[model samples]
Target: MLAAHFDAPGGPDNLYIKEVDRPVPKEGEVLVQVHASALNRADLLQTRGYYPPPPGASQIIGLEAAGKVVALGPGADGRWKIGDRVMALLTGGGNAQFVAVPATQLMPIPPGMTDTDAAAIPEVWLTSYQLLHFVGKVRKGETVLIHAGASGVGTAAIQLCRLAGVLPMVTAGSAEKLEFTKKLGAASGFNYKDEDFGTKCLEATKNVGADVILDCVGATHWQKNLQCLNTDGRWVVYGLMGSGEIHGDFLTLLLRKRGSLLASTLRSRSHEYKEELVKAFTEQVLPYFSPGGSIQLRPIVDSVFPFDQIADAHRRMEANKNMGKIVLQIPV
Candidate 1:
């Protein structure tokens, strides 16, 4: 088995592929021969020594993968069999050719979807779904604001909001990204680099403000995010690309708006929590990917790189040049 390895944490240049022992499945787990895996911000952070794999998880870098079930561990349910196509959310180790994941976390690839596309779905979609439904508690007819709209999670969030009949307003860095979000069902898009997105979102909603805000830009946008929320609105923060520290009258602002400020991270959660999330997502969203389902969400892949070119994939993400997920195709 070959996996991406880093001698030290720094830049993408630190990564190299090395032959490693294949992983074995544990009880209630399935061994998957990975066909494709998706790159994520967490991968970059791990490469730079900012994030480490959870306790007992594989040190290999990756958060999600699409593959075929090759074997099942003892006590695994009868629902899965050899050669079943599946995708899974991982705590780590998805960059390798083989990984052992809990059977409960495996999702069947929908008809007509390729392995590369399925590989892109698990992390971003699940995160966005959690932000929208669980944390934000978005309801139909509500207006939701999403920051970094061109990002993988952001793109998924836009589509999920549409599926729930909620209006999505997004913030992107460029005109093209804004247009891209509109096509993905955003009611309005703002160029955050050039305009005040908080004001623009309020304007788009005719001064009503957003009922929910899915934010990744953390501290830099914290004040504005609170200002853009409608009374009793929910602001869910999942990423802090800007900065984690807030240095203002944030408590007063929260009380003034009477809004809820929630923060969440999927990677650090317990296995039982992930299992519950996977189960809820499977029942509520997986059918949308089926051949004739009413919901029409799909993975938005910006580019695909071969496994050996993993460093280049990281570079693309670091540059903020990708519109959606950047994937790596694993050669069998």
Candidate 2:
């Protein structure tokens, strides 16, 4: 099997495809012949030597992939069978032709959805679902302020909020990106470059502030996050894209609002936690991805690059050029 590999910690240029021994399915795991996979910020950080794979996880970088089950490991046969088409939420090793994943983490691809689209769902959609429901415990009719509204998880969050009857607002870098988010169900979109989103969001909500805040930009968004959080609001921080440095009375403001400060990363979660989350997502959200479902939901695939062009895919994501998930088609 061929997989994406890096010789040393560095940029996208350091990535290359190399022949590696195919992994045998471990207990409770299944071997998947991957058809497509997608990029995430963690992949970037890993290649740059910032993030290392969790204990005993594959060192390969991709966090998600969609493929066919080729073989099942011990204790994995009851739920899934050989040749079942599925999408997997992986800890790593998804950037390969063959990767082994826990069978419980695999969900059957919804009818009529392409592998390319399915490849985009696992990481971003599941993360958004986890952040909004599991971590934040958001309820209907509440307003959520989401930063990075045009990225993969941001787009998924916008749609999921609308589905849950929550009002969603966003912050993006450009007017075009903001417009796109509005069409996807954002109640209000703020250009983070031109204005203080805190003030704009406050105005959008008539100074009542947000019930929950889903933030990926950390340090730069701290003060403003405090500015617009409602009393007893849940502020979930999942990523620190702007770096994790907070200045000035962080606790005082949080205490003033009685806000619950929460943080999580789906990739690093225990298998039991991920299995349950995957099951919840399968029951609650997977059906909507079908065209004939009551409320139709779609995975946003911004671009697809062949396996060899992995570096280009990384560059596009690094430049913030992708509006949604950037996919990589595994070599057949």
Candidate 3:
């Protein structure tokens, strides 16, 4: 099997294609014949040595994939038989021809969903769903602000908000990206490079302020996000792309606004926690993407590169040139 491997990460240039032994399914695992995989910021971080696979996870670089089941472990049920199409959020090792994923992590691909499109759905959708429903506690008629609204997670979050009948105020860097998010059901969009997103969000909600703020660009937006929050609102911080460190008077702001701040990372969660998220996503969120549902994958595939061009893909993401996911096609 050919896999993207980076023995020591420094840059995308460090990634290379290697002929590796295909993994066999262990107990409670299923061997998937991967067709497509999507890149995430985490992939770029993993390539640059800042992020590494969790303990006991594969050292390969990818977090999500769409594939077909080729084999299953003894404890696996017949529900996922050989040749079943599925998509999953893997901890690692998705940028390969095959990967062994825990059976519990797999979700059957919808009847008409394409493999490439399905590949882009899991990680971003699951992250958005968990942040909105579980962390943000977004309810219908509420207004939420989402940064990076043209990103994979941003795209998914917009649609998820629509499904929940919640209003979404989104921020993207480009006008075109803002338009793209609008088509995905974002009630309002802001170009953060040109406007103050906090003020824009508040105005969009008629000065009531956002009920929740799903933020990835931390530190730089921290003060504004806090200011934009509704009283007792939850500010969910998922990433810190702007600056990892923050130097705000958090106690003063929290006391003044009476709002709660939550910083969450999905990757480092316990197996039981992840399984619970998967279950909730499958039950509550996946249905919204089903046939006739309002929310479905609208993958903005910026480009597809061959396995060997993994480095170039990372460069595109780092440059912030991609509107959506960058996929690496594994050759058959």
Candidate 4:
């Protein structure tokens, strides 16, 4: 088996493909021959030594993958069989040609979807779905604000909000990205580099403000995010692309707005929790991707790079140049 490994934590230049031992499935796990995997911010952080895999997880960097089930471990449920097409959310190790994932994390690929596209769904889409439905508790007719609207999760969040009959507003750094969000069903988009998105969101909602706010930019946007929230609003923070320090009177602001502040990270969660999330998402969202379903949530792939070019894929994501997921096609 071949996988991308870094000599040391630093830049993309340090990454190289190396032959490694193939992983074996544990009880209740499935061995997958990976066809494709997608990039995420966590991958970059791991490369730089900022984020490490959870206890007993593979040291490989990828967080999600799509592949075919080649074998099942003892005690695995009978729902899956050899050669079933599946995608999975991983705590780590999706970069390799083969990985062993808990059967509970495996999701069947839709009838018509390709492996490359299915590879892009698990991480971003699941994160967006969890934030919107579980953490944010968004309801129909509510206005939701999403930051970094051009990101993989952002694109997914926009579409999910629309599916729930909620109005979504987004903030991006470029005009083109804003337009992209609008096409995905955002009610309004703001270029945060040029405008105060908080003020714009409030005005667009006729001063009522957004009912739920999904933010990844931590300290830099903290104050403004509070200002944009409606009373009893929920603000879910999943990442701190910006610095993590809070400089303002955050407690006062939270009390004043009656806001519910939540911090979440999927990678660090327990296996049981992830299993529950996968089950809920499989039931509620996966059907939409099936043939003849009411909605088709296609993954917006920014670019695809061959396995050997994994370094370039990391470079693209690190530069913030990609509009959606950057995929790596692993050759079998």
Candidate 5:
């Protein structure tokens, strides 16, 4: 098998493909012959030595994959058989031709959904579902202010919010991106590059503020996020696209509002937790992607790159030029 490889990485220039031994399924695992995978910011961080695969996880990069099951490990024979098309939520290692994934982490590809689309679903959709439903405990008619509104997770969040009857407000850097988010059902989109998104969000909601905030931008967004938070609101921080460090009376402001400050990461969570999330998403949300669904739920794919052009894929994502998940087609 061949997979993306990097040594002492600092930029996309350092990435290349290298032959590697394919992994075999362990107990309750399935061997998937990957057809496609997608890029996440975690891949870039790992390349630059900022993030590494979790302990005992595959050292290879990639967090999600969509492919066919080739073999099943012991204790996995009940529900799956060879040649089942599935999308896997991986801790790491989805860039290669094959990967071994826990059977519990695999979701059957929604009917008529392409591999590229399925590959885009696991990381962003599942993460968005986790944030909006589990972490934030958002209710119908509440407002959620989402940072990076045109991102993969952002796009997913928008549709999920609408389906749940929650209004979603988003912040993007460009007019085009904002429009794209609106088409996906964002109630209001703010151009954060020029305007104050927090103020815009308040105005959009009649100065009532947001019941939840899904923030990926860290330090630069901290104060504004706090200001826009509704009383007793849940602020869920997942990524640090901005600098991680912060300075200010954050605790004081949060206490004054009686708000809850929570942080979450899907990748590093326990296997059992991910399984539970997958099961819930599979039961409740996955069907929305199928044709003739009552809602407009779907995965947003920005672009698809060939596996050999892995470096270019990284460049596109690093430049923040993508509005949704960027996919890679694994070579046959």
Candidate 6:
């Protein structure tokens, strides 16, 4: 099997294709014949040596993939069988022609859903789903603010908010991106470059502030995020794209507002945690992809690059120019 390998981590150019031995399914794993894999910020960090794979996970770079089950492990359950088309969430190793995933983490692709598009659904949607429901605890009729509204997770968050009857305010870099998010159900979209999102969001809510804030941009929006949150609101920080520095007095703010501060990274979570997310997503969330639910995945593919163009994909992501998910098609 050919897989992307990084001799040293730094940039997209560091990724190189090489033949590696095909992995066999372990007692509790399933070997999948991968059709497509989607990109994520975590993959960028992994390439740059900022993040490492979990113990016993593939060092190969990929977090989510859609594929067909080629073989089941010795102890694999009967719910999944050979040739069953499924999508999976994983810690790594999705960039190859074949990757092994725990059977427990697999979900059957909805009927009539394209495998290529199914590839785009798992990671971003699941992450945004967990952020909104599990962490943010968004409530109906509440105002929720999401940053990076045009990105994969952002788009997913927008749709999820709509399904829950919550009003979503989104922030992105451009008008076109804002328009894109609106189509996905954002109630209000703010161009983060031109205006203060906190002020705009406050005005959108008539100064009441947001009930929950799903933020991927950390430090840069830290103070503003707190200011924008309503009393007792929860601010969930999932990523820090701007700067990791802290400047103000958080202790004073925490005590004064009685607000809750929570932060986490998806990759660092235990497998049990990830599996639970997968199950919750499958049961409570996956039905939205069926038909009537507004939480359908649009897959907003910016471009599909050949497997060898991994570096170019990384460059595109680094430029922050992509409007949606970027996919790498594994050569047959």
TM-score of 5: 0.99
Please report, in order, the local distance difference test score of every candidate based on alpha carbons. Answer: 0.92, 0.95, 0.86, 0.92, 0.93, 0.86
Tens digit per residue, CA lDDT, model 3, 1-332:
99998777688888899999998889889999999999999998888888988999998889999989999987987658999999988999999999998888888887777788788888898899999998888999999899999888888888788878899889999999888888778889989898988788778887778888999998888878877889888889999999967796967987788898888898888777777888888887766555675455455566787778888988988888887778878786
lDDT of 3: 0.86
Would you list the clashing residue pairs of candidate 6? none
RMSD of each: 1.0, 0.7, 1.5, 0.9, 0.8, 1.4
Error (Å) of candidate 4 at residue 18 is 0.4
Using lDDT, give the best candidate's number: 2
lDDT of 2 by residue, 80-141 (tens): 99999999999999999999999989999998888999999999999999999999999999
Candidate 1 local accuracy as lDDT?
A: 0.92
Question: For residues 1-332, could you state the per-residue lDDT of candidate 6 as single tens digits?
Answer: 99889999799888888999988989889999998898999999999998888788899999988989999888986869888999989889999989998887888898788777888888898898889888888889898899999998998888888878899899999999999899888999989889898888889988888888888898888777877788888888899898778888976876666778888778778778888989988998778788765456455677788889989998999999887788889886
lDDT of 1 by residue, 191-218 (tens): 9889988888888888889999998989
Q: Which residue ranges in model 2 land beyond 4 Å of their true spot?
A: none
Which pairs clash (backbone N, Cα, C closer than 3 Å) in model 2?
none
| C-alpha TM-scores of all predictions | 0.98, 0.99, 0.96, 0.98, 0.99, 0.96
Candidate 3 stretches with Cα past 4 Å from truth are 294-297
Per-residue lDDT of candidate 4, residues 1-332 (tens digit): 99989979998999999999999999999999999999999999999999989899999889999999999998886968999999999999999999999999889998889999999999999999999987888899999999999999999999899878899999999999998889888889999888998899889999989999999998999888988999999999999998899977999989999999988889888889889999999998888776666766778899999999999999999999999899999998
Residue 223 lDDT, candidate 2, scale 0-100: 92
Candidate closer to the true structure by lDDT (higher is better), 1 or 5: 5
